[model samples]
Target: MSEFEWLKRAHAYDEADAEDLEGRVIAALRTVYDPEIPVNIYDLGLVYALDLDEDAGRVDLRMTLTAPGCPVAQTFPGTVEEAVRSVRGVDDVHVELVWEPPWSRDRMSDAARLQLGML
Candidate 1:
């Protein structure tokens, strides 16, 4: 098989693979939970945006903590970046925190809702 074949195999990650990968990445994210919250940040409505930079094998993530004054604000960003870096194929992980819109319970994923018994 040629290098192109391998590239093709990966360049366009199928939906199932993408979902699997997202799940895996989120699982890794779960390992680093908020110090003040019972739930992992992944499901805590903190992760607001994600951009898969496939060509660079990097993932750019945008998120916000439950509160700006939260105690782990400094440590959590590094933790989030590291968590994403553990995912296979992600050469670099950039987790940026945005506060314009602010974080709220509505942003939580359905899985998170179930975990909190909100759904």
Candidate 2:
């Protein structure tokens, strides 16, 4: 295949002409750590969903904290929103905190469980 074709395959989102910007989203997500935990919020299982709107250059996230009464409830959503907004291609970010399904230890990423030595 040609170099241009390879480039498209490497970075282009199947839905768009622009580069897939998910990496930037993850990079920014790494900067947000749970206030009471040592792990990045992403690994903590706090983030339940991430949707990138290629056409709009927007990102939306649905997440939960360890507990419904988590002390950082207010701050956590703000932090994640800020992180997402910092990504270069992100035109806007909206973080929603949900407690309906709740958060549990099982939700944690392997890395998070390992960091906490729960492995």
Candidate 3:
């Protein structure tokens, strides 16, 4: 293959790898839950942003709690980081707690709403 074609193919492979890693990271996030809620964090829509660098095996996540005064606020980010770090390909995990948008029932996924009887 020409050099240009080879570069394109490599880029495609990298994208696919990144996507796969993102999926796994999301799955890991789903395994974490708020102590006060039965639903997973992912379904709760607390996870605002996920930046995964597959090549570096690093994941940067921005999330928020349902309430600022929620009891776990102090340690929740660490819990989230640990969960994400448990993923096979994740060598580094950083969890950032954000309250800018603030979490609300509206942020919850439909599934979460249904599970919580909000639907």
Best by TM-score: 3
Q: lDDT: which is higher, 1 or 3?
A: 3
Cα-based TM-score, every candidate: 0.73, 0.79, 0.82
Q: Which candidate wins on lDDT? A: 3
- Per-residue lDDT tens digits for candidate 1, residues 1-119, read 75334333432434225455565565566555667867888778788887776668778888898888988888778877866775666788888888869888888879878887889
Worst lDDT 10-window in candidate 2: 6-15
Q: Residue 10, candidate 3: how far off, in angstroms?
A: 34
Q: Candidate 1 at residue 46, lDDT?
A: 83
User: In candidate 3, residue 60 scores what lDDT?
Assistant: 91
Higher-scoring candidate on TM-score, 1 or 2 = 2
Cα lDDT computed for each candidate against the true fold: 0.71, 0.74, 0.80
Total clashing pairs in model 3: 0
Q: Candidate 1, TM-score vs. the true structure?
A: 0.73
Error of 1 at 87 (Å): 1.0
Give a tens-digit lDDT track for model 3, residues 1-119.
85334433433433445448887777666667778999989999999999989899999999999999888999889878877776768899989999989898888899999999999
The global Cα lDDT (0 to 1) of model 2 is: 0.74
